[model samples]
Target chain A: MSMERAIGFVVGIVAAAVLALIARKIVARRGGATGEYDERQQVVRGRAFTLAYAVIMVYLAVWMVLRNVELPFFNHPSSVLVGILLSVTVFVGYSVFNDAYFRTSDRPGTYIALIGAVGLLNLILGIRHWVRETTLEGRLLDNANLMVAAMMIAVMACVVIKLALDRRSEAN
Target chain B: MKNLKLKSARAGRDMSQQQLADAVGVSRQTINAIEKGDYNPTIRLCLAICKALGKTLDELFWPEEP
Candidate 1:
């Protein structure tokens, strides 16, 4: 790989690590002690992870077959990212419905706000990249911000629906 | 079968599901699932719930012989 690309990759990794640490700090502050999943939630989350792993395996298998067929689709890295996003969506959706996504001390509102903000930010960046593009050459999928925005939106929707269902159940 | 015994014990203490869950260090949904028979908690959680509700494990979790 080129030195510039290697440097960019290293920078990306470092930025992601810093962002993760910041997120952990925020969660710790909001929920006290980094927020622990209860036993039942831990069990449910484990099952969700298993299901997501299965999804990723299936997705990769399909991707491999498509590659052999020379199908016109997202580029290799973008395709792999799509598979990852799909699995993450499955995990998040299942966890939300199973009441395992949030910990006991977590306030769903805080997470909802955070997700909304991040999604909006990514959406803006994705839009800017789309505007600068001129051809249908898999450029859209290559925009990682768009993929992240889509994933965040899906996760937010799942959380909102779960919260609504919980409210209805409580009322009943 | 639903765990009506646990539900009753929690109610008897004038505790909401959330309150009992907080006291037992679990989520409200976990407590709800236990009451609805949707999730079977571990022994440690059972003990925690029993302690929180001031009930014995037999009273809250044991299935009565038909």
Candidate 2:
């Protein structure tokens, strides 16, 4: 209902559109196959999820420490939102890097670009919202949303790095 | 160890990795993984690969006794 959430909902829909594009292509390519993961992919996904979970826990722990130490910027109840964002990044980054999520080729340039562009837009919007907010909690929440954008960009960066490393290893 | 038999049969049939992967209804990377020994395909996929290459499961997948 709020402006920020309404815009966030729109962004979520767009992100989902990108995901659906990849999923539709995959299903079409597989001729309606549902469980396409092989053992190797399954293991990679399992490990990825585990790492994502760890990231969320560690992130929350750090935030708690910052708040306890009375750091000036360590404010706001961001546990739920930022935790969710960073956790998703871990999974997406891992899956994309491993050549498992897209079900398409390793040519992930388009999808990554789309996500990155949208994420930057969201980050700008979050900063604008933060500038307008009067309350500390509201400002903090806006910053958390900005972190969601950063998380998306981070995931994309990790995927690119993984792809580069894999390619180099192959050359060697 | 590589799936040398699968590679050999694919080569004998003059099929590219993409061709075999298409015939088996998977990404080319899946075929590459199978060949690289980094992935073990399911029994269903195994049968599909065997059928695609006109080879039996044992010939393509079974380890040779040293």
Candidate 3:
């Protein structure tokens, strides 16, 4: 509720939105005459998503349990960011695992894995206050870890399900 | 677990992944993925591959069930 925390949250949201918009534009540009998410890609993505969703559901259960237990540890803004980064890393990790198991050769799996790992490490440092938590006027930063986790889950689920459905329809 | 038909047909035709992809109007990466059995091609793309290699769907696909 403090000025600094509000600024940080706002900045995070803005950064996420900007990245999403840029990614959408890139996919759009690649479509040429036909739309991107072609039939094959959709199928591959769907399979990957199903696996990612299953893994995330498991992780979410664990997160909820941990939250309930409340480790007597301080809740920091950095923790929320770490949660977000971990969510991404786990998703991509599962995606790559799915690709390798299914014998899908798309290198996007590798790229996502690498990016997720780096983001995860950064997130951990940020969340632990190792990177320093913002404090101004004695007001605490809103470490919306649950909210961040939910956002990441929603974004990933939407992407995977949409592509899967698209592929199914195209196949039919 | 190998898709021997697809692999042999691709080889018999003297076409590499890049060559097959160029003929089929897809990326070489796509072809590589397909050959590795890491991906299944769409119907349209499967048809394209079939046509390019002078084979039918039954000939290229439809292996014994595992």
Candidate 4:
């Protein structure tokens, strides 16, 4: 992996650890000893994961076909990142909508903030790359990081919309 | 298509869905799904709900003969 990817991976792990710490604090503040992921949540998550697995399988199959046909994106080796990001978006979005990921005791705002933080970080980076590519003759625009950011933003929007709709429905 | 009996039992006890869900250690959405017949709880959860509402498994979960 490139140094950028290596750093990104380490950052991802650190972010996950930080998220766990935050969740622990939330659980403690709520006085819920169980700390989320109850039996029902697990069942929902299982079903969501099954669906996400099917999605990834289909995506990989399409990638294989495109590779055979010598498509531009698949012709390059790094296109696999696209497949992985798609699968991740589907998995996260599915779990978020199904209420399988975040604990009910945890505030929805917390997750929204988390997604917003990541999305904002990516957006800033992607925009900087875009500006460089457009003006000062930098590297190409077909960046995996930017593509991943776009996909994350799309998925985050969907999850947020779904959360709002569910809240409205519950109110009704 | 809900198991109205469970709903009635819960209401009869003056318990809201959220109250029952909290008592049984689940989200309100899960309890709503169970009552609406959109989702089935595991045997363990069924027992938990039964105990929370002071009902037997059959009283809360068994299918009634038409």
Candidate 5:
């Protein structure tokens, strides 16, 4: 790889790590020192993880088969990342529906706001990339921000729906 | 397979599902699931719920034979 590409990759990794730490701090401050899942939530989360792993394995198998079919979009480097994001979305959706996505101390409102903000930001960046694209080859497939935006927005929607269902059930 | 005994016990005390769940360190949904027979709690959780509701495990979780 070129020196500039290597440097950019390293910088991206550092930025991601720093952002993760900041997010953790913010969660700890808003919730508690640590979000504590009850035993039932823990069990549900374990099952969700297993299901997500199975999804990733299935996606990778399909991806391998498609890679040999001369599809330029499927052959993009971001395809693997797409598989990971798909699995993550599955996990999040499952956990949300099962009431295991948020800990007892977690304020779902805070998460909803945070996810909405992040999703909007990624959507803007992804739309910019899409609108300015000149090549038809892997234009959508190579845009990782769009995938991230979609995943985040989908997760947010699932959480919101679950919360609404829970509230209605509680009232009834 | 619903644990109506546990539900009645909790209601007899005028405690909401959320209150009992907080006392037992579980989510309200967990308590709801237990009462609805949607999910079975482990023995440890059963014990915790029993303690929180001031009832014995047999009173709350023991299945009644037909």
Candidate 6:
């Protein structure tokens, strides 16, 4: 297909992979031998996820309806990608909102902000793609790919550094 | 947010979040949140915190002195 769409697909895949790694770590940490996630945390997470799922489904329905309508600036793939990004973002938002409200925790806000930033970045990328009908091999898509890759690497690096520091302190 | 004298005392004793959580039978995240003033401990948890830090309730959670 178009270069922009191809770039979006690649970015989406990379984002999915990064999110998977983060989720795996969260699950492992939560299920570790020592002081794992309590029943209350699980209950809160379950409720939040349920609400997220509902919001995602509703977003999908709305997206489908909007796709049929002739929108001037919005196209098929961009709209679809935006819908998917927003769906996942809604989940992240739900998690942070629930954590802040019910658990009185502030840590989840960081995760929420990160997700929101990524969503906004993707939305910008989508709009840029629509304007510059470039091929995946073109400069625009290549730059976008590089930017996303850099962000993923940065996130992974930060996590690794934090874990290393934690371990080092524990040993001392 | 109220100051966490218990956490401050525990830290003064060179105890980590995990150590304090273990002593109080709670998660490390809970200890971290409490120390950061992002959580309000229950009465039972407050007692546990006081016990862990080797302090009385009044010392750890004093009223606003006039």
DockQ comparison, 3 vs 6, better candidate: 3
Candidate 3 lDDT over A30-84, as tens digits, reads 4432324444545656766676566566656766677677743223434444454
* TM-scores for the candidates: 0.94, 0.71, 0.55, 0.83, 0.94, 0.42
Score chain A of each prediction against the true chain A by TM-score and list the results: 0.93, 0.62, 0.43, 0.75, 0.93, 0.44
lDDT score for residue B66 of model 3: 53
Best by DockQ: 1
DockQ-based ranking: 1, 5, 4, 2, 3, 6
Candidate 4 lDDT, A1-172, residue by residue in tens: 9999999989988997997788667655654434568777888788878887888899889989989998766877557777778778887788777777777676666556666776787777877777768542233335655776777787778777887898799899
Best first by TM-score, ranked: 1, 5, 4, 2, 3, 6
Per-residue lDDT of A41 in model 5? 90
Q: What is the TM-score of each candidate's chain B when compared with the real chain B? A: 0.96, 0.97, 0.86, 0.95, 0.95, 0.81
User: What is the C-alpha lDDT profile of model 2 across B1-66, one tens digit per residue?
Assistant: 889899999999999998998788777778888999988889998999999999999999999999
Residue A85 of model 4: what lDDT? 80
RMSD to truth, every model: 1.5, 5.1, 9.8, 3.4, 1.5, 9.9
Worst 10 residues of 3 chain A by lDDT: A97-106
The reply for model 1, stretches above 4 Å from the true place, is: none
Q: Retained native contacts per candidate, as fractions?
A: 0.93, 0.40, 0.20, 0.40, 0.60, 0.00
True-vs-predicted CA distance for residue A54, candidate 1, Å: 0.4
Query: What is candidate 3's DockQ?
Result: 0.16
Question: Per-residue CA lDDT of candidate 5, range B1-66, in tens?
Answer: 788999999999999999998898888899998999989899999999888888998898888888
Q: Across residues A63-131, which tens digit of lDDT does each residue of candidate 2 receive?
A: 888888876555655655777787898788887777676544333665566667768877888888789
Off by over 4 Å in 4: A1-34, A134-142
